[model samples]
Target: MRADTVEPPARPSAQAPATSVPVPARIAAHGASAADRVAVTGPDTTLTYGELDDRADRLAAALQAAGARPGSCVAVLLPRSARYVLAAAAVMKAGAAYLPLDPATPADRVEYILGDAATAVVLTDHERAGTLPAGPWTVIDLDEPRSLVPAPQTPADPHIGPDSLAYVIYTSGSTGRPKGVEITHANLANLVDWHNAAFEVSSDDRASQVAGLGFDAAVWEIWPPLAAGAALHVADEGTHRSPQLLQDWLVEKQITIGFAPTLLAEQLIAAQWPAHTALRTLLTGAERLNRRPLAGLPFTLVNNYGPTECTVVATSGEVGPEGNHPGPPSIGRPIPGTLALLLDEAQRPVGEGEPGELVLAGPHVGRGYRHDPERTAERFVTVRTGDGETVRAYRTGDRVRRLDDGRLIFLGRLDDQVKVRGYRIEPAEITSWLTQAPGVGAGTVTVLGDESGEGERELVAYVVASGDQPPAAAEVRAFLAAQLPDYMVPAHVVTLDALPMTPNGKLDRAALPRPAVVAEPAASPAGESTDDVKVWLGELIAELLNLGQVGEDDNIFLLGGHSMLAMQVVSRVRQRYGVKMTLRQLFRGPTVSAIAAEVAQQQQEASA
Candidate 1:
């Protein structure tokens, strides 16, 4: 870490006033001042500050009685609801860190996290409690009326400290499982304080909680506004997924502050909104943003960047409308109390405007990964700056380039950088340009090995089109070839209506459909029609599934076809013959012959 040459934006500021109040304490203060104000709104519940504070107090007392204390971990396994917010506030009030568990988490993964964190109590609703794996831990159903009782409003805990664990979030690990990241109250307070100030959060503002319950962004979504006496609106499932629905919901609810992941944010910003819409700020993170907002977007579009190890957000900057700026939007400068250093593999600072691994240091840094000292040591290390001072920092595995103005432009993952024919490539760089290509709504590039060549890999591009007609694969390839080097251009392109995303909103690379194979069809047996629709479909199926051959009676799914691949096939058939096909029809008759017959019937009806 070279601090002497580092700019002010990358240096930890000692002059910044500390905003390290425990989150529960801050919320209680807000409750005292704004007791009648709306604090949380959900499908079936609307909580005033007084009611929310009282319920949290009651739950805190129950948790304390159920063996939760300052060092204990309490797991919250509820869906996104007002009760989930109450449970989080209560857990912290009880002087215990809450381990947020997504309701959709696999039972085994839930069991593993519960065991790994040594959770003393589980706070979940009745509907989700039955899904929890049996373990030697207390399970308190939040839906059970008898489980809560009134307690003191302040609900102060002498054991709570700035260094006390606030939350333990589990991020996907490189070892094919999950690892828990331990964040402290100080770390969380820094984020809440920065967010509240940066976004001008106030009691008059209604913030929306749309991120998955277990995502670290949920912490940012919950605490900052609530602490500032703002109302929290829990978006319904449909609103959470559909950008159009979310836009309407935000306008209808008069939500002033909202957050969406990168891809969703791209679509949301491009949409038309009323001139008098109440939304003033739209925040996005959790992935590299590739699109700019449309010219007339009335709100400030802020792009944030951070890892779970650094308490949700490290850098933030407002994104200007398209054409106002060139290239993808920057992640912005480091937030207050945080330091961002761009360092090379040799642990030295990279030259200005050069790419390097972003290493972060300061109060925002978390305690480290839970129960994995070895992995923790590998990622979190003490480094000596040029000033001869040693500081502990978390190494974010992301590759980024710093602009002259000190903002960070995300390049891609350092580990994700692949060498193709001796040339190192950043897929995100290609994607940034790919998304801007004609008729391409969004795209991601990945590397796959050649089927015929040993140890040879080529680029593969998967795109979702902006128009009804997907661009031809050859057209996309040619477009990239014009803008990029020959090696950087993808060898093949696959178009889909939408990209598959994981439950947490990140792109699911593992679920991406493989490129369709090309092969010459074999001759049909004597007397068989060469242009038979069934025979044609069999060939399409074989190529799509990369099968040696597909028989007429063979089921598509049985031959490794999935919903996404089936969608591609259906899209192809519609484009080729203009026949309407639905997923239900595909599932009803999964065999090639059955689908061919359905298509033929549709064609015959059209002709008649």
Candidate 2:
């Protein structure tokens, strides 16, 4: 530990104000008070406060008639459009908490979540409603002609209280099943108050909603701006992953407040920000903040840390442009109305400078997992603080050390869970699926190697065959693709006769061997292309993948392409062709031929 690693004694206090109002009430206040303000802005449409409020009111009446009651779970599973915002507000207007499901999620995962959540009604557009897996619930297409008109009569307030259920977000669980963290209106109010007060959001501020609805950060992205009477701009599809495109978008929109995952923030920090950039504040969390003390940025760079169980943000710190810290940067101190306690295995506070499991308790804490009493009891505990006051808190499985000065430094995880691209993944989730696959008796999955070496985190799996011959690594990957999302598919799959175990019968994680490269089926050659652009782009993509051959139509993501790889491809395109391609363009046109065609069109337009 360095000498300057002192705790921040003056960290923000967690004394939240007493509030009897729900989050919707706050929004309703804004709607009445700031009716002309831009409430929600997206690429295709925009909603003013009055417009959003009226639509929500009309839709709420229809929802109540359709049997949506208070405390019911109404799922909003639409694309990031104006309809998405309307559906969310309308669900709350109907006196029910809304569950947001990202349309990009795999069908299997969506099915599991809808069933587990006991969703009362799923609100989606006409195009997407048919795509949803048939479930034993009502699927209302919000785009239907009848839904365009709100029901007659102004619906009375459902009397949503501070203690009522607000939202239920699903997160990775240690036991292979996904757990839903039930956040109450009071928890949201605590976060909204702290954020609005801390950031000083006003009508001049334009906040960006870059996070997908499925992410807990979306909770923060949506509420704070609306509550502060600020404009909330929703980024279009394929904008979240690519840092360069997202940075350009932020600058173009003149957004004052924005939130991104840690990786993208690091990229933006490294980028050459425009001198007159309107972006004022960049808030990042969801993963560890590796690149600290950003250099030469005309914005307030805030590193926030929290889990789904504790609203969105528990601790947040703003680093200066100097980016110079005495030691390894920490996740910062507790946010307002939140407490961070470091305890040993016995739940006793550790000595100064010692590391222990982190426990978070405060007004921002949620109401624990939905319908999971056993898990709720285990993780959410009532404990006595050092001041001899008993309070309810959530036991975060993260390890951290409290500095002598008062701040807390994050160490690492105390469990097998890992975060990849800001998504919390349980190794057990992968191992459980591996064991169920045919010809597999038992299996183990590990996040292999250091994250830096692999460009990104790689989920590696080792499975012992139940038959005479072990299955091929490629074979297992294909099996997993149908059931798992693209991200959950292992980067490398290895076959083993048996796994090494210790004398005590516990599997020794250190003994697991490094995974070898898995052989994939050979791709057919790209036909003799006289077009130089096509040939150049194909070779560039092949070089990036280290593959022997890449067809013009080969999908980059399907062929093991990641965000880092995608960035490299874009960089090469800019270097060779002078065509500025967006990440969304790459996502839409993932093949070498498709990219070359896009580049060719740009050249044609330039010449014309």
**Model 2: per-residue lDDT, tens digit, 410-453?**
76678756877666786756665675566665567788656554
Candidate 1: where are CA atoms >4 Å away? 1-17, 149-158, 450-456, 517-608
Query: Can you write out model 1's per-residue Cα lDDT over 315-407, one digit (the tens) per residue?
Result: 888777777677678888888767788899998888877899999998889999898999999999887676777899999988888877778
Compute the lDDT of residue 40 as modeled in candidate 2. Answer: 93
Best by TM-score: 1
* TM-score (all chains, Cα) for each model: 0.83, 0.75
Range of the 10 consecutive residues with the lowest summed lDDT in candidate 2: 517-526
Query: What's the lDDT for candidate 2?
Result: 0.75
Error of 1 at 397 (Å): 1.9
> Lowest-lDDT window of 10 residues in candidate 1?
5-14
Model 2: colliding residue pairs: 7-405, 7-406, 7-407, 8-407, 14-337, 293-323
